[model samples]
Target: METFESLVRAEFTPKTTFLNTASNALLPARTVAALDRAARLRAEGGALDPLYADVEACRAAYARLAGVPVERVAAGASVALFTSLVAASLPPGAEVLTAEDDFTSVLNPFHARGDLKVRAVPLEQIAEAVRPGTALVAVSAAQSADGRIADLDALREAARQHGARTYVDFSQAAGWLPVDGDAFDYSVTITFKWLLGPHGAAFLVVPKDFGDLMPVQAGWVAGERPWESCYGPVADLARSARRFDSSPALFTYAGLRASLTLVEEIGIDTVRAHDLALADRFRAGLAELGHEPVPSPGSPIVSVPGLGRLQPELAEKGIAVSDRAGNLRASFHLYNTAADVDRLLDALSG
Candidate 1:
């Protein structure tokens, strides 16, 4: 596990052995660096120039991580609002395909819209459910409850055959797995989890060219010149995904920048390998204790049914985990190691 450990490990002190990464990641010391950097920026006369630079830096960093052009990635306050914007861009009567268990941020936009037809299907049956009228297929890269990952390739192919766009919520999978950014038309990731950023910052990725697309949420920041004038009309929408971004939060961006830097320095592939290995170890240990988890395709999230009641008790012993839908969920991140898994397993076994 040390092979995968980054120097950033020294900075983490969550007060408990946190296996609740799926809920929210523990903050890193690097966040302080970003905060200090922000302070320095404010100390100077004008903070706008450098704050904006941080925004662009974030866009660039996420773009590089997602393996798409920088133009495709946008700075967002949250996945929920931006996704609503994307869903609203669809024409009236456009059908959106999704699963009941799909993350709220990914599917809620379609569900909330009266004009759009939202069809809910089981994740496994999404391929068969894609109809010709389907405008978009919204799904999570990995299920938040049980850590079951969707087959993006099959989903993309199904959406393609029907001329539909696919939106993937990579909240759980992005920094821990090799996300197929090209397979989907749009993808969203809130950085607090695997990306190790703050709560408010998220990244939204769009394709280089949408054959037919409309802008639903046009804020001043989405214009060609956000700094120029908010009162004036946008003569031209931004050529890039920046068009979706509203006002960027420089304070959150500072922490996000540091987190992205950590992810970059350690490399995502290395982080993924570490995550899976620990997950495998954790599951195997649980199985030995006669509390085998429900079978799942490889995912950093591992869930054990009937353990929800145990979570509160375990936390008292300095072991933190998440409980959802009557299941105890243990989420492994880059910061977790074999030892953390042992601590969790020991708590559960006891």
Candidate 2:
């Protein structure tokens, strides 16, 4: 197995502990270079259309990472907007199911519409809630608050049995967990969390059969030919999942593609292994500090007691972490090491 130490070491800083990758991963040098390249190209002011190729490349990368076909992936700015778009696509009177406290990105979209019946149940009880008439079942691949990994395989199976479409927000799981696109009909992820890309870069994957489903929010980029003046007879749309995409900035596409190139080079399986090992260390160490961590196998997020109380203090010491539901959340990505966790533990103890 090739070690990723050098690759990870080169991308980020050593002084600060960035445990809040789940909030937003630090942009790598490669991503910055990509943004700069795009900026230079934009300054030239000729043929802005070719930059759309970057959007396609970004979508293709997400497709491969999600184990889905290129046609299933759509680029977007954020998961919340895409999730809401999918919710809006559902027919009126549709019933949407999710965990009672699933991420706002997962539940808020359905609830905000007030047209569909949104049922928020316990994670364990979600599958049982599925019915033949259920329109959609959306949940996070891993809980953001305390690193609770959902049983997606089982959930998808149950949803399939009930003829329900399954949706997963993989913002927290994409780089670490393999979200099976063949099983789930729809999935979305913001790459900044786990894929180590820029903010405002995200993807939504839809089933190939969804070509007939009109987009609830489509910008000019989603048209058959964005450069052409879309006059009368607006019948033709993107044949691929691109139809659902909004206009992501050119830099967003470039940044996502660049970071994804590094992610692919290091390899997803290796990153997953490294991240889990660090999380395991963090969880064990937190327990030794007399604080129980939320147990979430295969997830990089480890929840500790007094996280919110400690967040400001830890930040003062250049240790970055995020708080969720009153728990300290230390999220480990490929860049984190055991020393980082030790620093957090030491800070809490002192």
Candidate 3:
């Protein structure tokens, strides 16, 4: 396997300069080229049929990465959170359970649904909070803000016993961790946050058995036979997750495909190992600087306490980081290196 730094640098385009990837990651050269090719195809008056083919390729790639069948992969935009909401909004008056530390995007969808009651319980209390009337339990495999990882097995058992489905928001964990489809009745949703892809692109993978569960936002393309006729009566809903995919984003799929291909080439396990190594170095450096790093570790995302003013301070020195909950959040991807971590630590020391 190629070195992480080499893999990242080979794909990174110098045209666009990004300080840190945690906020909105910079797309690789392959992704840019693919998108450009797609745009050119459309500009040349190409039909949407060919574009759908490209989208299908991306769907297949994501399905393999997510450990689900292609039929279970649903293409969409930033509606990962929206898809989770639909998954949870099963029956009327059904309560949606989630962690208080969830991404705001995840919470906002259910919060806007007036008919669904939303309950934000602590991670430690999620199992106990899942009751009989609960409709869906939403949990992020890795909490976005604090980088805290959740226990999927525990949450899945809790939801299962209550006769409720579980929605695992894998946005922060998908490309970075190993996701097994058979582990739970999970509708895993993922964005390109740490996946090193375009921002608006994401996908939802629902198990094969949940196809008839009824999606509240079904569209024309969601018809069982979308291509049969533009105005025909809707046929049987798809017997897979594609039923929830109202429409596909051709351009985004092209970009995502390019990015995921690189991920596959480099291997997810290699990426995670490299990131964790860098994170350990970062945490040790921060500890030496008299700041306490978050106790838990999983994703490359690390939080340093009392580094409230570090973001701007580091920015002045050409370093970038995120400030969340009065902690400094630094994320490492395939592009980052030990030297980068050392530079960040040196900047923090000043």
Candidate 4:
């Protein structure tokens, strides 16, 4: 397809037509077909063999896309953020350094714990904040609010100097940007956001050596060879990050697998190009409407300064955007087009 319109026409559902793919993507018909088939098998109470196979395939697909070994990939809810905290696993009262710009979900796991100390520093000061006592330096590869990409390489070097590990939350970056897990010792990602998968599915990548350090959580399925052991004491912590994952949610796995397969078929570079082009269009359109774009040449995210105050009016125009702390966020993705950007500009003009 030469344009986003063609791609959407071919791949998306007609009833859900819209370019707000950054919020929650409209799954392709093929994904829906696969999910339906999987659900049918589950409904019939047949062997759950296919579901397990799909889960493993999903893990492998996500690992390949992330440039990490399948053994190092872990699955869970908010897996990236949770895995980062788990990777820290520091002694009580030890501090974990992160940015104030991070999504609230990243902070929740650490905030809920009393023993672990979480420190939020400005993005500019993150490198300087990684001290000897800091166990991990966690940050997003791209800030979710405004789509500003982080300097992960610099953070990684600083963490290395202090003998601390780096954990990157790539939920907003994956699928739309290139990610090298080696940029940090660990990286967390959610399949839902940029990966365009179903909600409640995420992946965590831990460096090989740190895999065994993950503390086991509830559920017998988390045990090594769970099906093989009846009630035997859980022995031999898993040698890979799979040790951190509990039982697979088969329904979400089915959706995630289909989504990843679609992404792989589209290719990452192509997706990035589409996202950046749309972002540039959005920035240009916002500027024409007398609103300041948050940052020039922004990533998939663009902010219109005044839209935040006009949310109710904009919603009436059939446009969906977020008003966050005084900025209206327009997030671009593979499905957006220059026409969509123009439409948003026109809405803001009034």
**Model 4, CA-based lDDT:** 0.74
Q: How many clashes in candidate 4?
A: 1
For residues 255-304, write the lDDT of model 2, one tens digit per residue: 88889998999988898999999988877777787878777877888887
Candidate 3 displacement at residue 72 in angstroms: 1.4
Show the colliding residue pairs in model 3.
none
**TM-scores vs. true structure, each candidate:** 0.94, 0.94, 0.90, 0.91
Candidate order, TM-score descending = 2, 1, 4, 3
- Candidate 3 lDDT over 1-350, as tens digits, reads 67666778888744312335557666789989988988998899977776777777878888888787888777777655455436454655678898996887677767666777888988768878899988878787887776778877778787778888777777777777888766655555545666767766667776676633566666666666777525655566655676667566788777877888888888889888987888889889988988887765776888877785678878777677888888888887777778889988887787
Number of the candidate with higher TM-score, 3 or 4: 4
Clashing pairs in 1: none
Task: Tell me which of candidates 2 and 4 scores higher on lDDT.
Answer: 2
Candidate 4 vs. true structure, TM-score: 0.91
Tens digit of per-residue lDDT, candidate 1, span 1-350 = 44334475675866778888898887789887777778777887654577678788888998889898898887888889778877877888988888877777887777788788888998889888998888888888898888988888888888889999888889888888876667788888898899888888888887787424466577788887776647777777888887778787888888888888878888988888888889999889988998868666688899999888888898889888887888999988877778899988877776
List, in order, the clash count of every candidate structure.
0, 1, 0, 1
lDDT of 4 by residue, 136-165 (tens): 777888777777777777888889899887
